[model samples]
Target: EDKVVQSPLSLVVHEGDTVTLNCSYEVTNFRSLLWYKQEKKAPTFLFMLTSSGIEKKSGRLSSILDKKELFSILNITATQTGDSAIYLCAVFNSGNTGKLIFGQGTTLQVKP
Candidate 1:
């Protein structure tokens, strides 16, 4: 079965801490790695990393995928209360599009 796992299940930050979120996976034939941020309802897309070390960044958020190691990482700098949300890691299969298979997610709590 293709599955994703994220570490440090939850986090607590005080309005300026830089945080790194880790995600690791095991799949029969990996295709892509995706990141999402959840505040309410469904998660909003963050990054889709297919190459290693090459980070995709926007504002205070950045992410990278390491296909060699079968893992990915997300970094958030200068976190604010607005940044508080759940981070989810997902894998996309070229053959499947039913819905995104989800990890339990890493909940981020940024205190003001």
Candidate 2:
């Protein structure tokens, strides 16, 4: 079975500090690494890294994938109160059937 786990379940930081969220996974026949930000009813897609040499970036957030290590990291620079949200990492399983396996998630709180 494929599984994902994230550390430091919750975090609190000031508006100007940067934060790095970690996600590790164990899976068979990986396909893609995905990141999402959750604040509302549904999560919003942040990045998807498939190619080995490419990194996904959006504004102050960025993520990288390492197929060999079966893990990914998300970095946020100069966070703001509006940036507070739960970060999730999911792996897309590739085989006969497709499925999304997600980590528990990391909650980030940025204060003014």
Candidate 3:
């Protein structure tokens, strides 16, 4: 079975602080790893990593994948109270079947 695990289940930070979240996975025939930010009921897509050594970035948020280590990291800079949310990591299992295995998610709280 494909599995995703995220560390530091929860975090509390003040405004303008930076945070790093970790995610590791173990699966056969891995296709890709995806990151999402959940603020309300729905989760918003953040990044999708399919190759190692390439860093994907959007504003103060960025992520990198390490295929050799079967893990990924998400970095958030200058976090604000608005950045408080749950971050999710999911892995796509590729074996002629479409499946997504998700982690428990990391909840982040930012105080002003």
TM-score, candidate number 3: 0.97
Off-target runs (Cα >4 Å) in candidate 2 are none
Which digits, one per residue and each the tens of the lDDT, describe model 2 over residues 1-112? Answer: 7899986799999999999999898977788889999996699999988876577888999888877777788999999999998998998889777888899999999999
**Pick by TM-score: which candidate is best?**
3
Instruction: For residues 1-112, write the lDDT of model 3, one tens digit per residue.
Output: 6789998899999999999999999988899999999998899999999999999999999999999999999999999898999999999998777788899999999999
Candidate 3: lDDT of 13? Answer: 94
Clashing pairs in 3: none
Q: Which wins on TM-score, candidate 1 or candidate 3?
A: 3
Score candidate 1 by lDDT: 0.88
lDDT of 2 at 50: 87
Please give the CA lDDT of all the candidate structures: 0.88, 0.89, 0.95
Worst 10 residues of 3 by lDDT: 92-101
Global Cα lDDT for candidate 2: 0.89
lDDT of 3: 0.95
Q: Give all candidate RMSDs, comma-separated.
A: 1.5, 1.0, 0.8
- Over all chains combined, what TM-score does candidate 2 have? 0.94
